[model samples]
Target: MRCVIAGGGPAGAMLALLLARAGVEVTLLEKHADFLRDFRGDTIHPSTLRVLDEIGLAEAFHRIPHRKAYGLTLVTDTGASRLADLRGLRGGYDYIAFVPQWDFLNLLTAEAAKYPSFRLLMNAEANGLIRDGGTVRGLRYHDKDGEHELRADLTVAADGRGSTLRVAAGLAPVEMGAPMDVVWFRMPREDGDPGETFLRVSTGRLLVAINRETYWQLGYVIPKGGAERLRAAGIEELRHHVGRLLPFLAERVTLLGSFDDVSVLTVALNRLRRWYRPGFLCIGDAAHAMSPVFGVGINLAVQDAVATANLVLKHGPSAVAAVQRRRMFPTVVTQFAQRVAQKRLIAPALEGSLRLTRVPELARIPVINRLTRTFIGNGVRPEHVASR
Candidate 1:
């Protein structure tokens, strides 16, 4: 069987790799010439780590420059409270690896190249579906030369939340509202800076500080659709907020002289009622756009690819719907958790009403802590690679 997968993000790249390894011809299309996009989801949770281990890429993945975060922490005015401790997990892969997403995708593509059946077309953007009656026959894409059509037995849309192919297939994800959008930027890391990555929360402010060894990748959370208003307030306003949340970066806050230095991620939490239609299938953010609450987006996408591959190999092109059936539970569970967090924690925090100072250390409780660790570290129904 032949498959054409769109968008060489985590889902498309991985599904292509697995299918090709099993001797099926597969082509992966990437709109960009390179995977160097900044502020993309960089958290590779243990569930994905275990998948790499199963695929014999775990050691190589570790070889790349990445930081291992053992736990999640919430920093407030009172003190820092541990949220989830990944080390408590049973699997040898206990920590989330914070690797630049480009490096991670490069690793997957490189390994995929070993199989002659795998074809990766860089700068090839899949724009629409090539339909035969009701079934998707292949894809119509554009490259530097011109637009073209490629025929395959199955067409997969792993293009992401704003997926072009998903739109072409007449699929729309049910919009689950998020209370905040994120402004992502960077500042230089200096001596005496806080080492571990943590979430900083204060009255009317929520910021995420990720340690990138040489620099700090910071995400400032603001009210939904508030990017324009924040810009109106001027760059100095952002600088002041960052300095207040992370006192250590007070001096270098001026590095953000303008808003152009940052990127805004409009947070979304939504999923499709149906992830597949005939020969077409949507996976990853195409099927379910995740909230950035737990950083589980990449891992979930990877899991979807793995499950899709296993089912396709067993049931052929007819397995398209099965992929959704197997993945829907986890998608629902994860998104539900994110929505709850948004309502209880993030929404309140952004509104300057989260009583972090008065609230008990909930993470210290055994059951809630274990559940949080498992939810973040392993995810729901973590899939294993099916034997070829």
Candidate 2:
């Protein structure tokens, strides 16, 4: 079977690698000629970690030199939450690991190359679906060479939240309102790992301190479309918000440099009511896109690839029902992101008496900080990947 995957991102590449290894002909297409430095979905979830182990690519992932997370911490708007330790998983591996999105994509692309059956065609944009009745039969694509078509037994859309293929297939996504957007950038972490969670309530924000090699991914949720205004106000004004978001790290203010191309992304949480139609299936962000909380977006996408590949290899089209059933529970990753959005945005604003009692300044209290950290790793803040 010739399996053609759209989107050279992690999900598409990983799926191609798995199918190719299983003796299937694979064609992977990526629109970008090269991996861009700045991108979204940086952290790799622990569930994804377990999948890597099964696929025999865990060591290769580690070779990428990504930062391992020991635990995560959370704070109220006042920045009161201290560090919560998430290393309680039996036999060591517990906390979520941080890595640059580009590096992680490159790692998967390299691994996909080991399979002789897998062929990658970069700089190719898949424009539409070639259908046999109601089923997708192949793809219509356009590149510098104008246009062409390729046929495959199966088409997997891993193209992401804004998937053109899914849209072309007429799968209208159901959107759950995620009303917040974020500003992302990098900053130097002088000491200790950058895998801490800082949630401050008074300032109305959430911060994910992701540890990279020399810098950390510092994210802050702003009112929808605040990024344009922030940069317009200049770096000093941006720092004011950052300082308010993470008071503990306020001393490290000077170390925080450059916006690194402030990215404005709203909480895009949605799922296609139907993930598969006949011979076509959508995986990763194409099927669902979770909010940024817990870094579940990319992890869920990778998990979808593994699950879809295993199901196809095991049962072929005969297992379509099983495939649909299997994906339902994992949809909770989207639900989980929704829950975080509520905690961070809706519940806080609407919690009448609770909001009054929840002192934003009390986040600086040591015990309060400890309590916040306690809730992060096991339940809320850190990453979760559901293994197949």
- Point out where model 1 deviates above 4 Å: none
Candidate 2 wrongly placed segments (more than 4 Å)? 76-84, 191-197, 229-234, 247-260, 318-321, 333-337, 340-388
Using lDDT as the measure, which candidate wins?
1
> Which residue pairs collide, candidate 1?
none
Per-residue lDDT, model 1, residue 241, is 92
TM-score of each: 0.98, 0.83
User: With candidate 2 superimposed using the best TM-score fit, by how many Å does residue 308's alpha carbon deviate from the native?
Assistant: 0.7
| Candidate 2 C-alpha lDDT tens digits along 274-310 | 8877778888788877777656677667766777777
In the order shown, the candidates' Cα RMSDs to the true structure are: 1.1, 4.9
